[model samples]
Target: MFSSDIKIHIHGTSFTIHTPSGKINISLPFLGYQNISNVLAATALSFSLKIPLKKIKNGLLATPILSGRLELIELKPHKILINDTYNSNVSSMISAIQVLDKMPGYKILVSGDMSELGKKSVLYHKIIGNTVNLYKIDEILTIGQISYEISKISNNGKHFLDHRQLNKYLKKIFFNKNKITILIKGSRNTRMEKVVEYLIKESKKHVNFVV
Candidate 1:
């Protein structure tokens, strides 16, 4: 839809949006083409309303990072946490995985099942697994029944029965890794945000929650 109206040229962390009036250069703090698309959607509406390009640019820049949606937190120096526990689907998963793939460090993907997929549940899970492997994500930890399909296909993935098992496994591995980026994702039923909570509390309280 934006192909003709809004032309986006991406270079590194910033992108230039071409418009009828001029250009709007945007540097969103978060990652993903989806976010840029969203910005374009807003920009299109704004342009139609005759809003100034400067105001649109400022608004895009001023937009805050929403929690559990590409929100960045430092577990420690060089170790980053991506709290993408807001929701889960094939599209969102791929976007998050792509973001993680670009980051330089020991990458870990902590994921849970994408519910209500009906007949294509297994296929969806397999796609996620293949994408992770294709992107060369270091470790893929998955929970729940359907997500087990992800681990099955991922080269470095391991399926866990529950959060405790996953946590224990995480503690065992990553004992020596110094620089790491951990992205947690899941549907609401999976309650993957608890993993984020567990990491936060454990990072502050204990010594075993490495990486």
Candidate 2:
């Protein structure tokens, strides 16, 4: 029920499709090319084959947003929190920092090291530190080994190598009366949710955790 020939022009590459699933003829433009042509070609072929559009629409609407990935929770004036701890890659980390930098309120970064970089592990950690400095983050609290590296670059931030250290420090400093805003972020493995939990409404000693 679809066209015999399907075409996808990505990066100025033309892929001509024949069968529902067959070898595709791909021609890419000059400079910076990868073999992702096969993926594009296959997608085109499958799309042309026989997939219901209603199923795609239903899937898009029903799919829930992944946790800790740009989850916004309102608390008080200028004290909103964004939970972006579901996953962490270099690009995602930089984007989170950029969001903090652009927004107002005393921003706090409770982040952990991004995992699975293979050989560029240390280099990536250092890049995180450098980006923090460039963004001029107000405060940074990190747990775990590599996360400590990120905190070290902050001129006015605290680094915690373990959860116990972080918990003790937060207990002392996270006052309920203060009017400062906070942002908590990290990799999913670090359990950044605990920090958010502690900042909930029950704790009256510190600034209002929720407005």
Candidate 3:
């Protein structure tokens, strides 16, 4: 999908198409080469027939982001929040921290355990903690069993056994409006978003609820 009229060369095949959006080259998996070729031929036919851009965009927009990927929930003048807690692995954890480092504002990491990696579980948790510390995060609150290990390795973060303890502390001790950016990331099983609920409780009062 080239934004301008340009030739697209794929494998040994080459053709030109007019696309208003940026050029996109899709490499189909090699399981069924004939099927992929057939689809590509059909798509080319559509282009030859001058298909409407609205129809193409509608088809593209039907697809959604993959589950357990970075999902942005809010962006405010004082804060930004991401629901990247859908899943966690070493790669995903590092990516989240990198995003925090590049963004301007105090970063709050709300992390939990990354389960089912078996033997590497402890090492993975420690890596997440190490990643958090390597960044200039203002504060960190960890949840879940493995996340407790993350807190142990953290230099300036706290660990919570449950949201109950976290809520109490946030409401009583560390409550601040628009003063920080929050990253709520963890495994889905940990239900870390309960902490986000606590933030909303305070946010309804017009406090800056930056993500």
Candidate 4:
């Protein structure tokens, strides 16, 4: 049986996993509450498999960073990117916004349309916009047709009909800013990874590149 006294504590970019054996300190190379929840689920699964506590700790510590899935990229002079381009749903988007609210610095959210939501797409998108408005995010950039719904409810949001326009605008904005955290997310069909790639490439040439 798993330990009944398990406790989890999140402090900034790191979190502590307390188990019966010992405590494991983990620093995720990603952002968002979903990523932390994924780590917790993995820890529980390892315990159920009878993996040694030490090995579990080491494994979690050594977990490789994944691309376009809550991946964290840092640029010199204090610019951070949260790339969660793997996919999106109403639930995940809300969780991402909540994570952004807790983070320090100037928070910017770049969101693309969430596909596969079918008949509920409009309603869900508006819901996301309303939730984002309640967060501490400084700016919201939305792309695609359905995503415009998010901008409607946001206090400081701009909607772009195409990726080209969005990319151009972002380049100008990112180049002039420092000490900012940007969260990028969308569905697979939305090809949101392009936004992440654009920012990374631009950062190298314009900003003091870090990682």
Candidate 5:
């Protein structure tokens, strides 16, 4: 459980935890409560190993996000992208959506598919849909057969047959956006990382070329 003194800010969160020695204040470079929960778990493990609390706090603050695993990218003057294409499941999908809900801007979830479920894949997808609705996500865009269930259940969702079609739609929607945050996710088998890469590449298109 998190300490009651937790302060979540736009860019980060700070919390004070009681330890045997006294109280230790911890801070992170990111704001997601799920991210903070992971840090708390890691801190517990470190405490069990008799590691110094100062070092634990410092280490947590310095750790960098693994690429394509809830990676946060700034899209120039107005938008942000959360690339969570490393893997997808009922829990992780919900966690990612929760993180997106904390962000500022128009929230969008881009999903591919969660694979390797012998059965109940559709049910799992529907759970994510319910979660999106619960959080009142602004929109959900989906690709793939199993993932389509998410959009179908969401109040404002659309399904794309292919990446090109989705990308085309995103470009149009992304134009002149005041503020937007997109969370892209799927299992490795779905190759959703391609969509992340395409978005990043497209974001750099407007950069002035000095030649």
Candidate 6:
């Protein structure tokens, strides 16, 4: 069971997880509606396995952050990089965009074509475009063939044929001393991490990146 009232904050999310014995407040380090779904699934599994509430709480808090999965990387000065480049699909892409909508500062979305989408690739990309158009994203940069469709529909979107050109453009953006939050995501084959690497290298701040 779960409580109806759930509160979200910049620090974390607070929700009630009800079990056979009682209910406990669970807090997660990450944001987004998808993460809440994940927590619910985990809670159901833990209840089925008869795990103690205390252990469940501890495990939830101790969950190791994954690479390229909504990982927050703080750059020098005042900029944030959201690295969710592990992989992408229609569902995940929409979720990422929704998360960006809630974030403060100038929000920029850097996305690549989603792979393994089969025959519906164009359709899915179009859907993503429409979703982005509906959001408050300040800028959108897309890569790959299908992703071009996203840029076509966005108000301030640009499509890059390859990473090199995108990197060149990003170099200029990073030089600006504005507080910006960038969300980078794409399919696994897109190697979106390279873009993040370039940004860090350009910073020249000697900061260690998690990816």
Highest TM-score against the true fold, candidate: 4
- lDDT of all the models against the reference? 0.84, 0.61, 0.61, 0.83, 0.79, 0.81
Q: Name the TM-score of candidate 1.
A: 0.78
Candidate 4 lDDT, 106-182, residue by residue in tens:
88999999999989999999999888988899999999989999987899999998999999887776666767888
The 10-residue segment of model 2 with minimum total lDDT is 27-36
- Give a tens-digit lDDT track for model 6, residues 17-39: 66656777865656677677777
Give me the runs in candidate 4 sitting further than 4 Å from their true place.
44-53, 207-211
Which regions in candidate 5 have their CA more than 4 angstroms from the true location?
A: 1-34, 41-57, 208-211
Minimum summed lDDT over a 10-residue window in model 3 is located at 27-36
Worst 10-residue lDDT window, candidate 1: 168-177
Query: In model 1, where do residues sit more than 4 Å from their true spots?
Result: 1-27, 41-54, 171-176, 206-211
Stretches of model 3 off by over 4 angstroms after superposition:
1-68, 171-177, 205-211
Q: Write the per-residue lDDT of candidate 2 for residues 1-211, one digit (tens) a residue.
A: 2344544444322344344444344442211122334444444544665654344334333545455666555555545666676778788788778766755666677787678878887778778887888885678888777877777776666777677677666554545425454567776777887767665543545453333
lDDT measured at residue 5 in model 2 versus the true structure, 0 to 100: 56
Q: Give the TM-score of candidate 2.
A: 0.60
Clashes of each: 0, 8, 7, 0, 0, 0
For every candidate, C-alpha RMSD to the true structure in Å: 3.4, 11.0, 9.3, 3.0, 4.2, 4.6
Between candidates 2 and 3, the one scoring higher on TM-score is 3
RMSD of 1: 3.4
Error of 1 at 114 (Å): 1.2
